[model samples]
Target: MPIIDTHCHLDNIQYQDDVDTVIQTALNEGIEAILIPGADPKDLPRAKMLAEKYPEVYFAAGVHPYDCENYDLDILKTYITHPKCIAVGECGLDYFRLPEDEIEKAENIALQKKIFIDQINFAKDVKKPLIVHIRDASDDSKTILMQHNAKEVGGVLHCFNASEHLLPLSEHNFYFSVGGVITFKNAKKLVDILPKIPLNKLIVETDGPYLTPHPFRGTRNEPKYTNNVVTKISEILSMSKSEVSKLTTENAKKLFKEFDIKN
Candidate 1:
């Protein structure tokens, strides 16, 4: 039952009061490791601290699309050098919440693309894998990734939205990270696409503090809940739970290439 939550936000305020307990519970449940993504510059320190405090914890250094407005490459570069920083993102295009004003929306899209491209280049420069986050901007995201030759360093599309258009990325060294959303009733699209994703490129995430799996949707998400994700994936792929766990854990290690699973 060894598992790795490749994208939980342990730095989120939701876990401020009891992150230790949450992490220990995850460990007790057989989640071997957790990677906190850097969505906010303010949280990178906290993420780093947690990674230092717990051997099972690691983190990525990059801003989310929603937080691109505050993007600062120099600031992110500092965290990129940390020994515990495993990847370069959670960064990419997100068009789900563009402004109503056409002009403002256009400007916003441009900024996100700029930030996204900058981060991609930065990842390449640092020679680290990326943890991409693409939403309604799939077309743009795929185009940018291809145009920029992101395959050089490789990466994972965190919370992969099941857009068939992005499937070709598999050939370019990209992996797809499925999260708790797969357990939802409306995840038919993702469920169907799951089998299509090359098993070698498949990994799992909780995306904790958000997208909590069923049987606990409204409650705050935590790394411990990755069990539900593994269960649903096993059912969807018709594989044993341990098989899913082993394969995904290996996929994560192959991509992140930072920490090793401790016995």
Candidate 2:
């Protein structure tokens, strides 16, 4: 079963010096494709180049929430139209790194939300699925997206962190994606919810260069570890690892059909 990493940042500096080796390793482990998102302007070109150079790689172009101080939506829209770009995101609300001062907190979040909304609009215009990256702001993110009528070809809440409150987003055509965190010791809640979530609406990712699975939590994360995540999620859902990989790969392909990735 070939796994698809739906949210790995292969263009990041963490893998810049060894991209060829990192990608080769993922192939060695049966990781067939990856969605490499450009979180910052400086990394956008890299994301495109990597996707173009590698047949199995695709790009998601957007400016991340944390770095939304001075964003240019027009440029984002322009760059995202490149043939290699398949989605618009890795963008969403992030309260984890907000300023310590209480007064500035609201402003920071507001700015992030504004940027997120703009990107959502861009996604709608381009008709490409979105890739959300919510961090400690799920409720707000859901509220805003819902209010804006996000159902217009809704996307996935990638690398989901909580399982208690399933983000009833499918009504909006959205799906939830899981990653290495589900394989952690303290993820019993997620494990319990795994079997409950609709399989067709579920997708798996690695978010590589970060969130490495349990067995290699402290080690540098890479796409090759996507297998461990698939194994863990499959066990939680009482299915074979191959089954999980197959479904998730299909889900990823359906979401990013522009790439023509055959599962």
Candidate 3:
């Protein structure tokens, strides 16, 4: 069975020097499709360019929480409709790295919420699914997603952090993605919760150049490593690697309807 890397940042600087080689390597590894998520407005064009260069590649358009400070929703909207632009994020609340000062932290949270909500609306408007990135702000992320009726379009909780509280989101059209992190020896939290994730709602990703799996721990991550994630999921769920690959790829295609899966 073929695999789809549901989330990756091929546009990141780490892959700049040999992106083609990286992409070809994944393809050679049976990765049939690759989705490059939008993290910053500046990276949008590069992402789109890659999508154009590779028929099997797709991209999303939204500002990440870290870049929310100067985000202009209108500017991001321009690329959301592109045929290769498959989703609306890599966007959501991230309070994990906020300031220590109370006032600054509060301000950062408020800005993140505002930008995240706006992008949620944009996804609804464009009639596309989302590519959410939540970290240390599950409550607010859940509240805002619920309040905004984000369930209407659905999305993937990218690189899911194993918060079972968010499991209810499976019914709300939110799928969960497991990344290379699940392969870590200390990923007991995620491993414990892996089985709870609905089979149909589980997708696989690499979050490349970050969260590189065990053995490759300190090395630069790439899309080819997605197979390692699938292997780990197989071991955890007691399923064959091919089965995990097929189901996860189907789940991804189900969410990203724009991608007509030939497999």
Candidate 4:
């Protein structure tokens, strides 16, 4: 069985010249495929191009919450339904850095909710899954997702660090994407919480260009190092490396399919 990087930004500008090496590293690492998540409209075209270049790279198209604050989805919406755009997201709310003014929070939440609903319905209408990005706004994210009937077109909370108690959000139907952070000594809270998640509800990622795991910590991350994520998840679950690899690879194919992949 081969590993699958469930979430990574191989489309990031940092990889332009070195992409081939990065991808080759994935292949050599027994990584069978990757879901290159689009961070914003600016990255979607490059994401599609990279997916086309790599036989194993699939992609999604949508705006990240941080970047989506000033969005004009109409333009991106047209191209979002393209064949290579298998999902709509990396989109959601981020109240972590925002002020707690009720009015301000409400306004941002409203905007986030609108985009989330729009993207969910677009995903439902276009017939694709979603790739969600939620940070410090888990409550709002869950609330709006439920209100929009997000379960109709299921997705994942990519690069998640929420508590185990919040796993019920997946009950409404979503997978939890675990990344390299779970391996760190300082992430004991997350590590202690993650094993409680059932294997079927989990997916692995690098979220690269970030979250480099231990030993490799403090360095830039990439899809090639997604194995570090799997290795740690395997340790937490007390499962074999091959088990985690096979299960997550199947999990990835189940959520997002592509022509190049023999789904």
Better candidate by lDDT, 3 or 4: 3
Best by the lDDT measure: 1
Give the least accurate 10-residue stretch of model 4, judged by summed lDDT.
254-263
Per residue, candidate 3 scores C-alpha lDDT tens digits across 193-250 of: 9999999999999999899998799999988999999999999999999999999998
RMSD of each: 0.8, 1.5, 1.0, 2.0
- lDDT by residue (tens digit), candidate 1, 99-158: 999999999999999999998899999999999998888899999999999999999999
Question: Candidates 3 and 4: which is better by TM-score?
Answer: 3
CA lDDT of every candidate: 0.92, 0.83, 0.91, 0.78
For 66-173, candidate 4 gives per-residue lDDT tens digits of: 776656667567766666667878777776666489898777777777877777777777777788887777776777788888888788888455656458877776
The runs of at least 3 residues in candidate 1 whose Cα sits more than 4 Å from the true structure, single-residue gaps closed, are none
TM-score of each model, paired residue for residue? 0.98, 0.95, 0.98, 0.92
Residue 89, candidate 4: Cα error in Å is 0.6
Candidate 3 stretches with Cα past 4 Å from truth are 261-263
Instruction: Return the lDDT, model 1, position 92.
Output: 93
Better of 1 and 2 by lDDT: 1
Candidate 3's error at 123, in angstroms? 0.5
| Alpha carbon RMSD to native, model 1 | 0.8
